[model samples]
Target: MRARRALLGIGAAVAVTFTLTACTGSAAPNDGAAPSEPASASGPMTCETILRPSFAEQLAELGWSAQQSPFRIGEHELAEGIQCVWGDAEHATDVAQMYGWAPVSPEQTAELQQYLEDNGWLREEDGDVVYLTEDPDVVGYLEEGEYGMTYQFASGWVALADTKESLDLITWRG
Candidate 1:
């Protein structure tokens, strides 16, 4: 009886351990290799790959280099997506241009649009393109001061830019 009780206790402990491990979503050990990144809609968008060559050259002429950064809405940083900022080469302090792109499901796209609407971002249409901007007065052009713009593409990419021209620079291969 004592031996049977001990064996049952051990079995229960093993089962609990397994259950907890499964609940934690731990994957099989990869033998010290780095874990693989999640695949993007087309491919992972990097600061180098997403920009048009001409735009990249233009940025270079202005002494700006692209850096990977976080995408923020208000004060909250989005957990997913790729963000790029163009700034001075040495310090990266002058972040006058920035953009973010993420592939979204239809539901997520709708939720984002609703969020923008609820947040009082003004929506403006320019031919086939729709832009949501923080300033209603900003139509097609970005003036001297700062502004935020968001665009949703039919190809499952939702993008945000600090300026309209910055948004225009992205090539959106996704």
Candidate 2:
């Protein structure tokens, strides 16, 4: 009789365990919530390949050089994107900085343009690309397309000036 009770107890425990597990699992992960984008389901699209070489050549022409900074890239934490920086120790500055990802919507672009204009940045339209500049320093360019947009910024008057010139030359070549 005791053996039979022990077997029944074991069976009851197994049944109870499965019941609890099923009850807990009833709360499904995507029960009603919309699907979310995976952080890195796809690889990052980087402009570093296209712009880095141009920046290197431009910096060298302006008596500056591009050296990779040790600091963590994408410090902005803006979004899932690529961030690259080259330091010019001679000027104690970043000679070239670029971050690019999927293109922002037209509305977002307009909003950003308005903010920059308010802050003294002049905008110039170059085909699908928009160039933003300010006196003495500050040169930034935004190019939009089906793939995405790339925004590149260069500081220091001479560096900014030459970098634009280099961009014009390179882009014109193709």
Candidate 3:
């Protein structure tokens, strides 16, 4: 019985040592390797980041400011991304411009394209793609009445805006 107890104790000690080594071995904080951070940490996509400098200046000239908001297509809110509304800050109802940017999988892009087609949004001209030159593989769509536009980038980003000019002002690096 005493021999068995000694063996058990030895096994327990070995197990504890293995566990400690395993836990600490991979957790070296100062091994000269760069720390992992989210892609966005370097330059996050926000209302400011997405806008062209001239457009941002124009909005400022017009006394318009941007505020974060939820992005929606008709009544359906997108699950991820950043959306911004630009207008008079004091009057909440005076918001006349808005934009949104979201990353999309190829499948999601196809679904969005279908959704736009089904809802009667017109496909924009190939030349219109020049507006967002940062994304060479972008395609644009336009909706009348409300004057809304949507852009799908092959880089896996989708942008929505209330006006074509708003679309023109966007620059996405995704």
Candidate 4:
């Protein structure tokens, strides 16, 4: 009689253990909550994503040097931005034309001058741009571009993005 009772007790314990396991492993309870949505990017897209079409990289592959780099040219910081190879003035003009960056206008030139001044860039002579910092990280220049008057950087260039949101899209994220 004691043996039979012991066997029943063991059976009851086993049943309880199996029930607990089933309850814990079931997904129905865990499915009640909605999943959180992934965050969307609001800033500059990665150079990797933009250049893969070869649209942005087309200039470099055409014997014009191009690589993606991120560096500080004075106050501004360039991260994962395209660094088009700089050559002689003729070569720069050819490349800029191909890229649709025509020369900027006089008014635009003033704007660029203001920007440089605001950013602590001092104008130097000899038709060359200069950064006045002891350890200058940026180059300064006045040039023309697709939008007319242009101020060029040693590592990057500023252009009026076609759409209002375009600037938001290209501006630094991190």
Ranking by TM-score: 1, 3, 2, 4
Q: After superposition, how far is residue 173 of candidate 4 from its true place, in Å?
A: 8.4
Cα lDDT of model 2 by residue, 1-174, tens digit: 353334334334533543454467632221112126432333333333323233335435556543332212123233432333433457664333322323344665555556656766666665445655542233222222211112322211001222232232111000
**Which tens-of-lDDT digit does each residue in 16-103 have in candidate 1?**
5544544566532212121254323446667655654445565677577877876555654555666886667775443345667666
Off by over 4 Å in 1: 1-43, 75-80, 89-95, 125-129, 136-148
Per-model C-alpha RMSD: 24.0, 26.6, 25.1, 29.0
After superposition, candidate 3 runs with Cα above 4 Å error: 1-42, 91-95, 125-148
- Candidate order (lDDT): 1, 3, 2, 4
lDDT for each of the candidates? 0.55, 0.34, 0.52, 0.31
By the lDDT metric, which is better: model 1 or model 3?
Answer: 1
RMSD of 4: 29.0
lDDT score for candidate 2 against the true structure = 0.34
Clashes of each: 0, 0, 0, 13
| Model 3 quality (TM-score) | 0.55
Tens-digit lDDT track of model 4 for 133-165: 211234212112112112332222332222111
| Higher-scoring candidate on TM-score, 2 or 4 | 2
- Candidate 2 wrong stretches, greater than 4 Å: 1-43, 50-78, 88-102, 137-162, 166-174
TM-score of each: 0.57, 0.36, 0.55, 0.24
